[model samples]
Structures are given as structure tokens and as C-alpha cells.
Target chain A: MKKYNNIADKLVKSSIANPERIYNYLLYISAAFFSVLIIFPFYFLFVVSITPQHGLAEVRYLPTGFQWENYIDTLEIVPLHQYILNSIIIATITTVFVLIVASLAGYVFGRFKFKGRGVLLVAFLIITYFPGTTYIIPLFRLFTGNISLFGLATPDLYGTPWPVVLPLAGITLPLATFILTVFYSRIPDGLEDAARIEGCTRIGALFRVIVPLSAPAVATVGILTFILVYNEFFFSFLLTDSSYNNWAPLVHGIQMYEVTTVRGSPYHLMAAGSILGLIPVTVLVFLGQKKIVSGLTAGALKE
Target chain B: MGDVILENIVKQYEDVTAVENINLNIKDGEFICLVGPSGCGKSTTLETIAGLTKPTSGEITVADREVTYLPPKDRQIAMVFQNIALFPHMNVHDNISFGLRLRNFDSKEVKKRVENAAEILQIKEILDRMPDELSGGQQQRVAIGRAIVRDPEVFLMDEPLANLDAKLRVHMRTELQRLHKELGTTIIYVTHDQAEAMTMADRIAVLNKGELQQIAPPLKCYNEPANQFVASFIGSPSMNFIEGKIRSGGFESTHINVDINIGNYDDLSIGDPITLGVRPEDVYPKSNSPEIQSQSDPIDAQVDVLEPMGDEIFVYLRLNVGAEDGPTVTETSSADQLLMSVDPDSDVSTKDNIELVIDREKLHLFESGNGNAITHGIGEQTALNQNR
Candidate 1:
């Protein structure tokens, strides 16, 4: 009787089929797996940045000893403070300029009816689809005044900060405009009409009513522009050569440190520079994650 | 001071004529409803009056001033939309006082006006709460409060109660009338519900296919429709139309042959196709009625369906004009089916054979081709006429 009872109990336990529970388990397992995959790099980066002077040559799962001097050494070797200030200036100006141009363009694209609206929108879409590097050669020639457009020589912008700021703003324009356009389109026309009837001109209504409501999209665009200009190295490298290192951004400065100081990859210093460089933007994204999420899912769901 | 007049108002979209030749005069403190089916240009007319849409060519005079080209803000018109349009991010107080603050009104006056509006809308305590926290009905009140604080000369509402539940809608209807009485401002309401138009508007303007069908008091439009479309549209279950021809100094058809007293309709002649219409209540089941037997020829019909409304029953009967037996009715189209409104206490069922009769004095005649009402009654009928 005891043996029969044990066998029946096993059969009854195995008979349970709950697809929902199974799906939940599968979801959790996959999510945990991917989470580790994504987080492992940052953990490794921190570990390498903290490895002691002699620990770089050791093969281990983690640093044997911690070194607090690497961060100080990185700042001392490279003019990290000056590079950070330069990056902040360029990213700030680019973010502001992109916001102004893209928001206005987005408003016009969203609400206005003019000839060639479709064609112009399609052109903007095509520009967004291509990688910015595709225009690198032409942009280099044009900025350096080496090319003529319609038989007119372009202005010389090779060594100044203008080339970096201008192209960064232009490259980021399409994304900002796309975000703001979708945000603007989701607003009901009735709201504008209500504002118009409530004693506001079109532009006044746009600033008073529409702008305040688009805080999430604006934050998203601003953050994206900041991150783009801050991490951008190619334009900064091409625009300002070694003689103009004063205008060199943070990433370009770090790249110079890697190339000039060491013959090959310096894992400890590279990890240390990357960790230090990502601090500001990581803080920003963490702070405004809610806004970014809302902006991305603006028209799809209610909340 | 809020009388509005539109002269030769024509609005043309790229390939569609939204409205054309719309001329209307809405007097001060009068409630006028522009009622029609969707895409009938009633909303276009209302929007034109509100200065939300520019007319291709017209002169819009509001409060004795031409505002044809003026923007909505300068026109002294405030509109309430169907969606309520309460700004989601702002609290009720801010949503209501935003316009005042924008205009640089003194804080004291803005506060006073907002308070007064809140009291009127009965949402004073919830002023600090965001819009999403409020119920749909409360949100609508906030929207109305926003419009009222502007104190515009003309109030335009485009189906303001359309989004509410039926019970709430009925309640809001009375509430709107009360508000109109208290404020006494010119209101132009647009809706597709004839019942709503009839209940609220002092004058109802009916439109069809972008053209005005009739503009008169609700009861006047109901009693004396200028065209067959208005007659059919103004009533529920619609006024029944029995197509026949003028013959032998009366009317004749395969399913129904009745002697209609048109009271000197001289233009009508024999062999002219005419459509006779009667309200459902005016059609009685003569042979089955417990009341005195009708002194008229019995109309042989078979009851197709019975719709039992609470107070009254709508009996749909198919007519028989020529058959081999007592119910000898000819093979006629389904349009020959007659609708009769009877008291709910009557004994009637689906598929029952019965004889019906139409009230002669309540008859209406229209030309078949153009749908022009040749003879129609004027003034209101009894309130308990069972018009459904």
C-alpha cells in the first residue's frame, strides 16, 4: 500500500500543466541571462580600472588588489579637465541649437500645410536613414574650403570649433525633429483651436500650450543630442588637428592618450578613461529614464 | 449683444465642398442647434461661426461687427469640443484660468472668475487635482468651466454631451439649459441627434448634403417640414412614406387606395406620382382596436414585427391589396409596409392579421421625384402623440 501510494502521488504531481507558470519561468530565466550579459561588461570595466599597477599582467576573474591611483594618474597624464570642459561646451551648444531648429521644423512639419511638404519630409527621412560617415569626405572638403559649390568656394572652417559644433548639430537634427514631430502630431487640433479662441496667436499658442506639453520629448531630444556630441570623436578629430587640441572633445582626447602613450591597447587606462567619461551622461540617462520611456511610447499607450 | 449673422458662407476644401451658400442669423441669447447626419456641413457651419475655419467667401457679422477674417480669439467666441479637451497635465484651476493668466488679468480677478466658474460647474473642491484624476463627467465640467471663464460673446458647443453615458447625457442636457438661462449668451450647438436638438434648441436648423433643409423652432420643424427630408429626419422611426399616384381626385396605389383631402392642392393632377406620409401614431389598427370602429375602409395587412416600447408598441405590418381571399392585396414592394404606433396595453403579436386605417387630417403629400412637401401641417400636435 505504501509503494502504491508513493507511485500515485508522483503521477498526480507530474500531471499538473500550467502554461502560464512555465511562461513566467522562461521569461524570468531569459531576462536574468540577458541582464547578466549586459551588466558583465560594466562590471569588467570597473574591475580593470581598479586593478593595481602589477595586476594588469595577471589572468584572473577579478582584480587581485585595488588601486585608487589610476583615476588620478589618468587625469594627470591627459588634460582630462580641459577635455571635459571642451566636450561640455560643444555638447551644450549643439543640444540647444538642435532643440531650437528641430522643434520649429517639427512644428512646421507636423501642423502646417505647404507645397512640397511630403517631398521635404521624405528627404528628411532619407537623410536619417544613411550613416553620417557616408558624408565624411565631402564634409571634410567643404569645411576646409577645398571644394566649390555652384562655382563658389566654401568658407574655411577646418581648424575652428565651428566645424565640430555645426556638423554635430546637423547630424543630430533629424532625430530631434523626428521625435518632436511625432510628439506634436499626437496633440489634438482642438487644443490649438481652444488656445486660439482663448486669446493667443498661432505662435503664441505654440509656445504657451504646445511647448509646455512636450516636456518629455524635449528632454529626450536634449539628452540624445548631449550624448551624441559628447561621445563623437571623428568630427572632432577631423575638424581640429593636433595643433588645435584645445578644442578637442573628451573622446578624442582619450583616443590621443591611448595612441601616443602606449604602443598597443592599454586595458587599464582605457577602462579607466571610459569609466570616467561615461559618468555625466550615465547620471543624466538614469535621472530622465522616465521621460525617455514616455517619449518613446508617446502615441502607443495611454500611460 | 451676441447676435451672429453669416451671409453667403461658402467653404470649399481642395476637392470637396464642405459647405456652400450657408446663410443664417443667430440672435442674441438664442439657442440654435445645427443638426444633421455626419459630413452634412453642420459642423463646418458652426466652425465658421466660431472663426476656427475661414470661409472661402462670406461676411460673418457677430455683435454687429464683421469678423470674417478675424482669428478665433478676437471673435469673442469660445468653443467646447466633444472630447472635452481638458489639458491632461494641468489641474482644473490652471486649465480654467490659463487663458486669463495669458491675457495678463489681475490675479484677484482671475481667481474670482475661476472660483465663480468652479462653483457653477460644482467642481470647486477638486481644483488642485489633475485632469486624469477626474471622472469623464467631471472632465467635461472642467472643459465647460474653461470656456465660461473666457466670457466670450458666443458659446459654440459641438456635441458636448456626445461622449457621456445616456443617463449622464440626459442630466447634462437639463444642466446646459439651466446654464443657458443663467448666462443668457448666444449658443450654437451642433449634433446629429434630432432628439437632442428638439429638446434643447430654441431654433433647430436641419441640414442635408451640405444644404439647409429647414430652420425653425423644434415643434415648427416637426409639424411643418419644408421638405420630405426634414419630415423624415425630424422624427424617430421616421415619418412613414407610402408612394402612390393621384388618381380619381384622390390617391391610388397597389397596396393602399385612400381618398386624401389635400385642401386645394391645385398643382397636383391625376397620374402624378405622390408620396403620402403619416406619423406612426396617426396609423391605427382599425379592425383590432377596442375603441369605436373606424368609419373607413379596412386596410388589410399582416403584422411583420412588433417592437414593444415601454409605453407604446410599434407594429410593422405588410400591406395586402390584391389576393384571392379576404386579405387580397397585390404583390407590392417591401416599401408598402406600414408602421403603426399603438398603446402598449393593446393585444398585438408578430405575424397577426389586422386591418389598419390612417388619420386623414394628419396626412402629408410630397412630390415623389424632388421630395418636396406639397401639403404639410403646421403647429404642434398633442404631447402624448406617440411620435416614435
Candidate 2:
């Protein structure tokens, strides 16, 4: 028994000398794989954008030669500058509207314990579970009808920015609301109670105390909504026509340039449009990355 | 101007009664600690007094004003939370000045009050620091500072020191007492810790199961606990309870025989089952020592365990003698034990057969059925004080 105890003690001490070596190697391998997997698409997009239009016939992962004119030429094919500005305007307005609606809705859902609160929140969640394209035909009819459910006089919203803005806000509202509500609930209502006792009204407490403390969550919601709206293709494609190309988002503009002929794809111009479309979101995420990360992981840290 | 009164406050939810008919009057500038176990509605009582939650059927009059239906903002009160809910986004200065600014106090006045509060809490250097940057004690200090700056009639604190380390909690307890003296504000503090209640409260309101148990000065509540719950809850190493009956003219326990002369009471009669209660300090080991040998016969018990806490040792002695011929006194359950707090310097060890005697005057007799004390000492001049 004494000899067996000594052997076990020696085994433990030897294992301690190389603590978690296998775990470290496995972590390093998986991290490298994930980084390559994430970076490969962006690299592919950039390679295809700068590759020569003539060199497209050759089978290659890397660009053979730079066709810098394809960047300028893609603008002519689809009015890419106008489309980029339109996408930016649509995404920005939609994000702003969604944030206002979602914050108020999220605060109500998170903090208040009214009757049917769980049912209401679950109903909102059910809206997100359904694909956004399922109600497109009815939404189009509602906005474009002379007899409007929105109580408008001879309303036709197809050619206007309202059609795009309204649907985008609708799609983004549920997820933003979900994120903000979860974050808001993590914040103890005691803070608001403290504020209320400090001479602030309930609404005043909501604005002054709860909103200020919710900056990380707000950033999370804003970034997620912006990225979704900026890259939104199906709704922007289906909701608006080519005559209203001035209001078309960048995703719709990029899809207009896609031509699959027997020769080859216009991988160069499409990739250029796609990269231009990616800039706003990349800049936004770069700016608010810290807040976004902490916001997403807020409730996981108990303290 | 902070005299607060709750008249029959009853708060009932759909499935549970949070607080039931609690009537308490807190005088102006008194530091009252509401101590109870969790879910005892101590916090609910404090919240209802603060106007944060309305009682279902009650009248609350604070500073002689009927604030029963008024919102929290209309009521002149401030509160600190157990979690120390300092706004994470704001620095200490902003956190302290939040209320003043919201009420549209001028910037200069807000700054003056904020700085004044910072001076009191001794956190002036960290005024610009965010709450996350501060330590737990400093953050709680800032929370108290936030409450003090408002200068409300009443300050409601819900377990404000529960998060700090032990040393910091003690330090903050003294600091809170000093602040209470300096400010002279009515404070309704709630905590689950009986030691905090004993140490700082001018008066402690003991509660159990959504009902108020007793409200009295600390030693009054300690020495004369109103019921079985208050007796058990208010002391460290709790008072031992032995079950038996009152027969002939003395108190009796089933397992041991230490005769004590229990006087006559109105409702207590002969052959009535009684619970015998005694503090650990009252039970002493019998020896040739004159100071410990008392009026009663020495009952032999075996020392089961010894817990030495610095200057004192808690001796757990059980009745280890073989069964005698007197009916075994009804039951011989496992908890038939006696506890004695002796000096740590005393020579005693586990599993030793030692003779014991209890201070007859310090014994507590409670009715076994409802735990009402048939006869209890008022604790004005306790045996512990004489020993000290």
C-alpha cells in the first residue's frame, strides 16, 4: 500500500509538471482553424474584385493581375455610388427607427410585470421566427392600396423610401428588442427604484438611469440592426423596382450586376460591389466592437 | 421631520402574502434595524415605507403626511440596495448629483451638494472614478453618499453591507453608526444578520414569516425575546431548548434532572409540558470550583464536542448516564443535550464524564405546544454581565 501511494503521488507530481499541455495544443489548433475559416471569404471577395476581367477565364484562387478599372466600371453598370448612398440612408434611418421602438418596447417588456407580458413578448418572438418574405405580398398591398390600413388618402408607397424603411425596421425590431430586453432585465430594477426615490419620475428614471447604464446593449442592438439592414437583399430586391433605383440598397444594386453566361461570371464587378457594400458595416463594427462584445455577453458575468 | 407610521399595512400578491398587517411607528431620527430571515417581508415592509411599493390595505404617514398612495418621488426618501445599484455608466460625482440635477437644481448647487457629500463619505479623490473602478466598500460608500446628498426625511437601506468582506462590514457598521449620529436622519435598515442588528440599531424590529415579532432596544430584544423565533434568531450559538414538563414545583427535562424552582404563572399549571430554554453561558461544568457550583444538584453529562472561539469555549454535553427508573421522562430523542460556554483556559476534553449545574435564575420555561414563555427572565442584569 505504501509503494502504491508513492507511485500515485509521483504520477500526480509528474502530471502537474506539464499542466494542460494537451488542452493548450487543442485550443491553438481550433483557434487557427476558426481564424482561417472566417478570413477566407473576405480574402476570396478581395481577390475576385481586383482580378483582371480577362484573367477570370483562368482557374485560380489568387488574382493574376489587377484590373483597377473594374472598380470604376462597376459603378457605371449599376449607378453604384447612388446605390451605396441609398443603402447607407436606408440602413441608417431603419436602424434609428428600430432602436427607438425596440428600446421602449424592450424596457416595457423587461421591467414591467403586467398581465399578458410573457404572451406579448412571445408573440413578438414569433414574428421573428417567421421568415420576413412570407408576408411580402400583403405588406406591399397594404402600403400601395388606395384604401389603406394605415389610414392614408390614396397612398402608393412602392416608389418611396417608406416602403423599404418600414419593412426593414419591422424585420430588425424583433431581434433588437430581444437583445435589449435581455440586457435590460439583467440590470436590477433596484437601480431604477433608487432613481425614483431620488425624485425622478418613472419615465425620467427610465431615460436617465436605465438608458445610460444600457450603453453596451444599445451598441449591440445598433450594430446588429445596421449590419442586417445594410446587407438586406431579399426585401430590398422584392419591395422596390428598378425605376426607383435611387432608393435601392447596395445589396439590391450588387444583385443587378450578376450575369451567369456560358463564358463565366462577372466575379470581378460583383465582388467590387460587394466590398463597397461591406465598408460601412466594417467601419461601424470596428468603432463599436468593444461595446458589442460586452453587450452580447452581459448577463453571463454575474458580478 | 421623519416620524413614520404604518397602520395595518397588508400586502398580498395573487399567490402569496408578502406582508400581513404590519403596524410599526418609527420615531423621528431613530435608527431602526429590521432583522429577519429571507422571505420574512422585512424588505417588503421597508419598501412599502419608502413608497416604492404600495401596500394592499394600509395607511402610511411619513413626517405626518399621508404618503400611502403617493409615488416614491413624491415621498421624501432615499434608499441603498444590497447589490449597491450605483449606475455603472456614471462616475461617483454624477451618481451623487443625479437626483439634484433631475429636480433641476442649478449646476452650482448640484456641485456644492455633490462635493459636500463627497467630503462626508471621504471619497472626494475618487469623484471622477466610475462605479466599476471602485472597490466594494468604496462603491457602497458612494451609494450612501448618493442617498445622503438628497437629504431626504428617511433613508431606507436594504442590506447595504451584506456584500463586503467581514472586516470591511464591521468597519462600515461603525461608520454607519457615526453617520447616523452626525446626520440625525430616520433610517430603516434591513438585514438578515442579527449581529448587525445587535451592534448598530438603536432599536431592532424582529420579524418572522411576514409578521412583526418584536421591536425594542437591542438588549431588550436580546434579553427578553418575545417568542421562540426571536429567542432563537437573536443570539449566536442560539439558546438551547429542552422539552419536558412542569411537575411538583420545578422544571423538568426528560433526559436529565437538574431541579429548578419555577414560580407560579397565570396560565401554567401542574403536569403541563414545557420547553426548558437556557443560554450556553448559563450552563457551567461542576467541579470543586466554588464560582460554578450553584443551588442545583450536579447532573452528570458526557462532553460530546468542544468549540473554542478565542476567549470562550462552547462545551456540548449530552446526558450519557444509563436510563433511570422514572419513566425515561416520556421521550429519549437524540437532541437531548446541554451546551455550556466556558473559559477557553479551562481543562476539558471530549468524551469525559463531567458533572454540570445550571443557573436556576437564568432558566427559561416555554409552553411546549405554542412555544410561549411560561416564565422568562427580563435580562436586565444577566449572569454574563456579572461574569464579565
Q: Candidate 1 residues A1-303, lDDT tens each? A: 999999987756655555566578789999999999999999988888888656777836788778878888778777776777788888889988998888789889888888998788778767767776899899899898999989999998876777889978877898788788888877777777777878889887777667667878888889989998888888878878743254888887677667667555566776788788888888878887755434322221122
Model 1 per-residue lDDT at A271: 73
Q: Which ten residues in a row are the worst by lDDT in model 1 chain B?
A: B379-388
Clashing pairs in 2: none
Worst 10 residues of 1 chain A by lDDT: A294-303
lDDT (Cα, tens digit) per residue for candidate 2, span A217-261: 888788888888777777666667754354777776777776422
**In candidate 2 chain B, what residue range of length 10 has the lowest lDDT sum?**
B378-387
| Tens-digit lDDT string for candidate 1 (B1-388) | 9999999999999999988788899899999999989999998988888888999998999999999999888888888988777666577899899889888999999999999999999999999988777887887888889999989889999989888899999999999999999999999999999999999999999998888888999998888788889999998888989898988536777777666443346868888999888889878888554443322346788887799998999988887634566342455455767888998999888768778877665677889998888886422222232221
Number of the top TM-score candidate: 1
lDDT of 2 by residue, B1-388 (tens): 9999999999998999989899899999999999999999999998898888889998999988999999998888899988888877678898898888878989988988988888988999999987877888998999999999989999999999998999999999999999999999999999999999999999999998899988999998777777778888998889988877766545566565444333435666668887777788877777734664343556778777899999999988767454454214344345567788998898999878788877666767777887766666422333442343
